[model samples]
Target chain A: MRASSRTPLTTRLWAFGVWSVVIFFVLNLLGLIGSVVTSSFATRWLGTWFPAGFTWKWYFAAWDEFQLGDVLWVTFEVVGWVVVISGLLGVPAAYALARREFPGKRFVVLLLLLPLLVPSVTYGIPLATVLYKVGFGGSLVGVILANLVPTVPFVVLVMIPFIEQIDPRIESAARVFGANTFKVFVYVLVPILMPGVLAALLLVLVRTIAMFELTFLVAGPGSQTLVVALYYAVFAAGVRAVQSIDAMAVVYMVTTLIWLIIALRFVNPTQIVARAKRDTSH
Target chain B: MTDRGPTLTQRLRARGLDGVTLLVLPCVLAIIALFIYPFLYGLWLSFQPKDGTTMGNYDRFFREPFLYKTIWTTLKISIPVTILNLLLAVPIAFRVRLMKHQRLLTTILVLPITLGTVLVAEGMLFYFGPQGWFSRTVMALGLMDHAPSITHGYWGVFLSLLITGFPFTFLLTLSYVTGIEPALEQAAATLGAGPAARFREIFLPLLLPGLAITFCLSFVQAYSVLPSAILVGDPANTTRVISIAAYQAAFEDYDYSLASAIAMIMGAVQLVVVAAILGARTLVYRGPVAAAKG
Candidate 1:
């Protein structure tokens, strides 16, 4: 390579600018989160770079005051049900889409995409309206049902690419060995599909937990998720210690961060973005 | 001899194997019952009037100018955020391609998004509030005696949206940038193409479609901002987006019909924007890889 081919000074400066932006972005995020973590533990932090003192009492206060025990339990219940139910319904549909060919298949796929393509509030208000009409609105059932609309399709779409990667001959070979359809799916298919299924379900678990719009719209007095509860804790017409609210935010951050880390183990972040596109558009 | 008719067991197995209805009926039923039915129901409800007149909710929405102001409010925030994300994302995404630890950097960047909008907003309040370090630092620097508040106006909500949106757009752009074969850049370099020239000629064409789609997706995501706007912005209506309007129309006012109408309008605007972007997408030349795959 010729030294004359070196990057020009302006190009070097431009590259420097780009790197600075990256550093700034990282520092900004760390500052935001670090401040919250610090504040949550601070005894008193009034306009200082470092907190005056650190304590753990705010966590206990946030716990008892926010009824976090119940909120966590409800979040788990909602996420668990949505994950399991979407898996049960979605895996088979994905299997069929991966393996079968039939009329109007593209149409069915498009129908599935509708729930995901349209913003949740667009469909959420209507869905909640029907749930309220049916005496299910503001209930845990409504939240679960509402979340399932987007999640089930998500499972089906994410699973489709995974399922398509497996050779169809394996299932056919099982059938040739006198195995029934159920046996082929249970013994032959499940082992091969386990990784994909885990990935899909884990991602679904993360999504359901972080999903705010649908849950917020349908959740009732007794059915508030952690996110909705945190929203109220911050915005509800009452004065509360900032540290306590920050504590609750930390809890949310940790919970979702854990799930997302687990999800990243099985899937590339870009693949997730790509999946969103393929799942929605064609 | 006449061919023997298929037996019941054979018929059942056949149905299980290839019967689309048997295989797909449950999911189809679920989508219809849960998704389609509700959307249609919302549509019907939007049109229904409590006073027994059609279009009443829409009429009321149109009659009150303050109610429809949310459209302008949402667009003002969403458009700028989308533009800012694209501008920052393109440069950062290009630089990231040069980094060896691209995946780790990406993961670190995307970590905040996993926290979701609510936590991010709450964190922003403490970190960017009047008495927060940002304000305090500026005060300490003697720029002003009083600390400036970022968590109580358009700037607060805009920053939150930026925080949430930047990583998403960056991730999408990175994928698209990396999807372009490095061999192309190397070839351009060997041919004496400078960085800018190579990017303009080789990368820009390839990245445009993906960027369009990314912009649309990110814009839609930002446009539907509710929690951040309400949590961090001037709640007196500075950042009162359309979604907030819909929420209030239903829950606070007990006017589900009006709420549904506002939601319908929001959906329409979003759809129009998305459709236009997608339409523009068709005009751009998709490369051989995309074309062959499609």
Candidate 2:
């Protein structure tokens, strides 16, 4: 309050400096993405301020050339299964962790934390190997199982705070009315936790969509998600037109941006910091 | 009415286990089967080389300069990028926390994350390439006589890491910055402490632990730079991070054992860094600090 009404020139200068950096970073980021969008529609982009001409053929070319139809379908299938399964497994675990004082509670918390802490590539290699041994590798099931390693823990972590905010007495009241745990969960807690659940699942959806290393490690030709597919397209850069690749990049951006917008609507980014702080103390 | 024996639910409840407690089972089991088991398997697999002794895989990893140097290459890029991102994020987050348009700014910043690294790398290839807009604009403005190749090298990977890593660091740092009770700073100001003094004495101590955690998380992400390094950087040399080495071993050479070894080394290195940072975090202020209500 008083600080906001500051008279100090140094503090004002500092604020100005910080905002300048923020603006600069955001501008470059926008420009970088804009160039991709611009190039995707360009007839031919050489060394110039603008492309030689603009066109819409890149999108069609990218779709057919990359077999994007199958990729999109696979991406949706993987994200869908990951979101649903993580929610089912994570929400109840979050409830238990939030409300109960059970033995090995610390161990459970640590167990969940490890998957998040370890980089995906580290575990992804071995996980893929295991999946291969079990005959699930390079299949849709392998990708889903690999992705769930991170998402389920993520869901559990994100949902715990939401569950903690709810009153236990609500569950007790339902139980007193002869509602079993399952019934109370479905009828009482679910309604109250709907917003939190949506937020958690949406985040999981966004994360699973962008998740690269794990999916890349486990995905087969048929199981490749949009991000992995984009990687391949970019990797084999010389074979395809630059415009088409850019078009695919734009498509990936739009796909993720749409979900990100929806996810942001339900969740505050700062809450992640709160969760991080809690984990540290634990 | 005849009294019934203690029910299963009641019996389970006596041992601190109930239907609710059992809800954690599915998640825990899933993690164990998927995460813990694979990790253990990887650790075991690392020792069983294709033809040599138990330590052959790890020995081969360390024996070759190309393989062992990736650890250094990964550290070189990741450490600087992580440190730079933290440095940039803290001030911006502090500034953003005071702004009225916090959500708007945060949402804008979070765009890079959802775009994913592949898209970011692709965008970089165009925007920062030799003939891309950046060089063209710079040359047109007489900022330089020749175009600079920012892509296809270390700078490309570094820039991409900064772009993607900064938002995550900023968000975490912003939350921590905002978590500090404003009244404390106000009280400090009332007591004649200037902005610098208040931050140094009050904010920095509280922010340090959170910053350490942020550093660890951001560092881990940067440390595993696979897509961007390959897409933007000279993957065989400058940005041959440990992850790429592991990938090559596994897929390129079809050597799962060696790949698992490289992965284990990578994990070990990351764990050591994380443990050190977290260990150092404890030496700072560990007392209760109020978390501002959202």
Candidate 3:
């Protein structure tokens, strides 16, 4: 692919233009994030290129003011349940969809895709209302259940390709060797499917952490995730120091960034797109 | 073998519904309870207004300019953002697909996804606000006489959408662009096709369908601009998106029926756009390309 020496001037110029845009975007992005990080540690920042002074007060202030410890705990609990539950429900469904030919399979695929294709907010309001009616709204359990609406389908979709790529003969071989369904799943399938399962759940972890709409609609005072809490902080802006808000923002960034880095190790970003293409093309 | 009755699993397997297929039942049931049931309930609720009249909520929605106009407001922001993201992503993805080390650049591009819309909005408030560094820098460099008010308004929400949506669109586009065989382009080059010809004739055709899908997905993301729209935008006026309208109806007014009606409208609009794009895709090239590698 490195035929740069013989490449035409126009091609090189086009490449340069594209890279220029990318660099400009990356720089601005870094600058934006840098501004938040800097302000978080700043003692005072107002109409200046640099803060007048730097301090750690805002971190403590934000931690205390936002009750971030509780928020973080809630966030962790919701994300953990979402990841584990979605995996248990979605992986088996994915395996079935990949291996079996059954009636209404296309309909089942469409049903799964509907939650994903529809924007969350469209479903979230009604779902929140229903949860409220069922008396689960405004709590951690409601948040977890609300989030699963999307994540479960997401897990199913992501795992199908992984399950499909595994040769069915392996499962058949295990069956022929007198391994029962449960035994094959435990001994044979789990080990083989571990990587895909890990990747899916990790991506789910990242997504649930960042998921705003569903959680926002369903969460109560004590049930807010970090992202939703950040929203409320930014919403009621003047009640807190700007620096403190920035500190909270930075904390949210770090939380998701950590998982994002780990998720990248397991799953390529392009594979997400590849999966989307495969799902849509059919 | 005949002496023993068929096992339960064996009986199920004969009916094309084996024990394995039953594994799917839990997920299907959960989706029905959480997603589908609520959707149907919402549909029913929309018809049963406080006034006890079917279509009352939708009627109220269309009658009120503040409520109905949100559809237009949402489309205004989402359509343009989706188009702009696609326009930027295609060229960049095309360029990146040829590079040896694509991972680093893609990773950098996708960083904003983890930051979520709230952080992006917060960052934009500081970076693009009147007193923000971007304005301060531009003024210091004499690029402009005064700092631009890019945040807390229409453009603020637009920029936020662009910043967050671009990475997703680019990643998807890159996957599609990479899926096409490089050999096809080399073959075109061998046939005396220039760079522009190769792209126009070869890449563009293969990319159209994927681009359409990318447009729909990205558009949906932008369409549901709730947090950023409220934080970065003038939600009372210019950037009152449909999601915000539904949110206000449900929470502030304690009106679930109206909220559900608005939600239904939002879903319908998105479905129309997605269906239209997918339908247009059928008019374009339709063939098996090699799956994405690396």
Q: Rank the candidates by lDDT, best first.
A: 3, 2, 1
What is candidate 2's lDDT per residue for B81-122, written digit by digit as tens?
A: 999999999888777777887888888878888777988999
RMSD of each: 3.4, 3.0, 2.9
lDDT of 1 by residue, B90-109 (tens): 98888888888778888887
- DockQ class, candidate 1: medium
Model 3 misplaced regions, further than 4 Å: A1-6, A272-282, B1-15, B286-294
> True interface contacts reproduced by each model, as a fraction?
0.62, 0.81, 0.83
- Write candidate 2's Cα lDDT for A1-282 as tens digits: 797665667878888898889888998998999999999999987767899999999999999999989999999999999999999999999999998888899999999999888888999999999999999999999999999998898888888887887889998999999999779979999999998889888888888899999999999999999999999999999998999999998888889989888888777765533352333231
Residue pairs with colliding backbones in model 2 are none
Question: Each model's TM-score?
Answer: 0.92, 0.95, 0.95
Docking class of 3: medium
Top model number, DockQ: 3
DockQ of each: 0.55, 0.65, 0.67
User: Global lDDT for candidate 1?
Assistant: 0.84
